[model samples]
Target: MKNIYSILFIALGLFSCQQEEITAEDHLISYDIEEVPVTEDYTVGALYVVNNWSSNIEEVPLAGHYLNGDEEAMKQHILWADSAAIDYFIFRYSYPTVNADNDILSAFLNQNTDSLLNFALRYNFAQMNLTKENTLEGQGKKEDFIQSFKDMIPYFDQPTYQKVDGKYVVNIIAANQFYCDSLELVYHELREEMSALGYDLYLTGEQTGWTPPARFEHYYFNALDAVTFTNMFNNAWYDRHVFLPQSLDQHWQYSKDYYMDKEGIELIPTVAPSINPKISNPNASTYIIERDTNFFWSILNVAKKNIGPSRTIIVNSFNDWNFNTQLEPADSYGSSSLQLLRNQTKKN
Candidate 1:
């Protein structure tokens, strides 16, 4: 009987030892999880492409039909975008509207902080969006917008999750010079207020003619993560070398070199689909996007190679009617582009 009791004690000791071993393994599993490889084949790891600057420009908050169409109705149309595993959604909202609704903004940030800090936020400056002002860029509204962001920075600093560098992203689109002029001073002040916040700002502009000085020169570009281009053109204007297909790599290389050497910063890549103004605006100029999925795939491949990041990529837009680069799951394509994005993102 004494021998039996001794055997029971030994078995209990062995079980306790095994339990300790399992707990230690679980604690170290994340660190032990194979690090994301940076091999040639290990592409498309962390990348993204948004269609355009997004906006919650809804004045009435009518549930179904939003700024463009009905919410429930549009989902049926969001075929391609339904399963798109986009890493970050740079949701854009006008500065003026944010300025007016401190309470709403605070509530929104609180609710979304959980999701957005994990994602990305690219605040836009659409003067016509917030107010009925035809154009604020012409009327010293730049300063007003800058002041608005100064107020916004503290909120950006207090987020649930931030980028890999702990910096929050803010993007501006439009007259590059005007916005930059406002931002240069604003960011400096913002940095002071939120010293611990290593927040960065991104400035995007339409490729204003290929010329000197690059037009958009802001003091903050030096402190920015990247400067992106919004390709508003169709087919990226292929170089018709005697009707032969010009390699996308060759043309982009020169552009990349010039942009990097001259601007002293890397540029983001973008591929667009069809841009039809008739769908949304009759006055806007349209571009011919013959191949949608192939174009998207090519750009994704290029971005994966050049950026070489597991995440953070740019797309022309998800839905911009005037330039018609929407990926919002149309009944026509039936989620083809969106499915491709998900599948490609999942690939080796």
Candidate 2:
């Protein structure tokens, strides 16, 4: 009897250990990343809005403390943007629901100061899992999208919501993932619903479809008002151990050339200070792009020339801590990027 009990305990211990190992592996499972070398020279240029990935106060580390919707911290962030002449923020609005951390949106909306900044919603479609099996059918998925839009109707009515051509500007990220045979019908229905509710949406589709330019033109561009790249680099670039500056420049040029002559679709180019996702995801396969203010300025300058002043230029992010692409003040690089942005915007 004693031997039998001992054997059962050992078996349970082994099973628990195996479960733990599986969990760890599951967390690290990501798409295989590829890296390519940079070999081209880039021209220098001016800057656009110095936006950061604005997060819940809890995401930011201030004086060794994490803040969550702290009004003072939120105000300080706005002050930083104001000082840097950042026109507005592209706030990440995760779908299916808005989390409590989004209280920062309310803080921004409620502020009565003259230096208040504007914001537009960037729907994080990837996280929403709208493509999950059976999710696209019936009322569940469509209702979710509708409700998400309804929730933002109040924000859309606010004077500070960013607009383009007199319509509220909204960006859908990973829009390709949402594409299906019936996507056009979904969009049309949603647009009709939104029109009924008195909100005109100026939608921009980011990173749409597998085939660049072609799929985007055939599927997404017709539905969206404009299109843009979120990070301006292909997965091959991110797979490498070291990022080549020339590769980034070449990629930007290719993107610019592809969209420059497109007669009907508008292109909004994105600029980034760096690509350093390893800071948050240790398992991240890509390496950081060696960064300086010049790299950022040159990219913006090229984009401004290619897209022209009429189109808006989106900074990759202001506070995306997960991938370490934030332009916010950090312990290692405090306000350097912001100052660079300020200098460039002032030139404009």
Candidate 3:
């Protein structure tokens, strides 16, 4: 009887150990047969928002909410981004604002002297409060608007500025909100101005196909070299509270078919690590996509598979705790997101 009881205890211990091993192995990402693609030379950039970092955030960062201009924080960020194999940092900017964004950009430029990683600009026109006169009709306002690009020439000339095929990459946020007679003309003029200064510009607009089948004219699509989103959320799925993988996957397919295949505009897909709008946008419909490393891995695979010839993918953000789409190290998931990113990038 004593021998039998001892044997049963040993068996239970063995089973427990096996279960633990399996659980640990499950955490590591594995590729599916279809997912293991003949990898392309892909470039990935993460949106880096410069904010008053001392403010409150629900998803506490591992390093805490440090100031935007903190040199150490910026240095750490650079190191982490490079380690993660991130190609560049896409920063949010606004015209004529010498605020936190400028301060952080200056800090980044000053610190990242060796050009360890590249950087790009995404001008949020929505923050500019431009009137109709400023966009089209007012005398010299059009030129004034064009001059903004010229002002950015110094930054573009930097060794760290992101470029593709000899043209500097610049993105416009809220371009759809630009109340103008011809949005196409505005972009054309901007390009012509840059050309005159011996600089080729690759402009990307962030205003196409929030809804699956885009209704914008063909000429409208021609305004920029490519189109992308800040965060590609499936509104219908969110509204219905059915956030499945297919809900997101179908959107990528739609963008590929409609924007790239049909319209001939390159679509730079933005993949999210996770999304939680509950904190910053309480009044808005509350939706949360829990922080799952596998979810990020899957979305990244989807993005890579659907990428246009440009071979570019934008991670929604590197540090946006408000909407909770950040890939930066957080208290709950320290460096795991970056690790996963590095894994995917290395595989490709």
Candidate 4:
């Protein structure tokens, strides 16, 4: 009877040891589970700056002025943008003299804090030195365009490059200049070549002029992935001498209802602090929109309500001082615009 009891105790001890072994393997199994990669949510308020980095002057006569490509000045500018929740800057890239601007972008990217901010290229092909001889219809121009895309592949592949719907986003300024038939060919060839190189492209056309065949039809012939407006209002409005916020609101509603809702095309809306072309061209008229906090707050609310959270909201510029539309810190406004953007973005 004693031997039987002893044998039963030994069996229970062995079972307990086996249970401990199984528990040890459970943690190892858990560790084998792969962690999911963190990705930015597109539904959030992601702000982009249509940055103008072409300033040559080291200082302006105006207070709070700084050079466009000055590394130290840009560092502060980027810090302010980051604080304002700006996700990216679509640097305006014109041909020939873009090397300086490109260097500025490179400097920004080289910063350790650059992960909080990013940049993409806004190719200003119209301003580029392309003549009729080098247009898409002209010989060798199509190949030239393809080569440009190939050259950009390295930049597009960078970790900080902005992507929409899993494809690198490239905004083309002056899209109307490209012939539709030629553009279609160029689009297809670019897509094919890019795909072959294991990359995807999302081309956006910054279509100016209020007149349109509806939003979807805007890019029907051009074969672009999406369409957006560079300037929301017509030049006629600029000549009117009165810029109404109500009119802007009505235009927003029209775009939201007709273009976005009915046509089902992705729309990226632009919000300018003010428009003062006269600052650059003395003879030009000025259509000033007020820059009070309420001004940006109202526009942001309208965008949120109408456009939803899935699309990017573009600020007209970061540093377009000559045109008087910069959001950079100025001695006049201080950080008022930046504060407004940060506040509005947070509230929305």
TM-score on alpha carbons, each prediction: 0.58, 0.72, 0.83, 0.73
**What does candidate 2's lDDT look like per residue over 67-157, in tens digits?**
4445666677777777777778776677754553376566655552664677888777555545435445443566677778878888797
Clashing residue pairs in all predictions, respectively, total 20, 14, 0, 0
* Model 3 lDDT on a 0 to 1 scale: 0.74
The numbered model that scores best in TM-score is 3
For model 3, how does the per-residue alpha-carbon lDDT over 1-348 read when each residue is reduced to its tens digit? Answer: 999999999999998988744542243223241363535557888888866432436667876777876778888899889889899998877776658888788889988977899999987655455666664434345676788788888899898899988899998885656666677787788888789998898877776335554645343476777777665652434422343444445666787778766667787878888887655656656457778876787777777777877789898888887778888888888899998887876664
Q: Write the per-residue lDDT of candidate 1 for residues 1-348, one digit (tens) a residue.
A: 999999999999998988744442243211211122224332111111222222421111112233332234333333223346544434454565644234323433444423522334455566534332433444656557656666666656554423534455555454353333344455555555455444454433334222232445452254444555555343333332111112333344555565567565555555455444344444434435543665556555555445512244565565443345655544456556656666555443
User: Listing every candidate in turn, what is its Cα RMSD in Å to the true structure after a full C-alpha superposition?
Assistant: 22.6, 13.3, 12.0, 22.6
Q: Model 3: what TM-score?
A: 0.83
The runs of at least 3 residues in candidate 4 whose Cα sits more than 4 Å from the true structure, single-residue gaps closed, are: 1-64, 95-97, 112-114, 127-135, 213-222, 233-243, 256-264
| Residue pairs with backbone atoms closer than 3 Å in model 3 (clashes) | none
Local distance difference test scores for all models: 0.44, 0.60, 0.74, 0.60
The count of backbone overlaps in candidate 2 is: 14
Regions of model 3 farther than 4 Å from truth? 1-38, 52-56, 131-135, 138-140, 217-219, 234-244
lDDT of 4 by residue, 1-348 (tens): 999999999999998888744453343222221222213322222223333433532223222444445567667767877777777877765543366667666666666264877677776666444554566645445666677777787778788788877788788776756643356777888889988997788776776644443633644344665555676532545322233344454565666556545545556666666655645555654454545665566555555444533456777677766555567776567777777766655533
Q: Which ten residues in a row are the worst by lDDT in model 4?
A: 29-38
Supply the global lDDT for candidate 2.
0.60
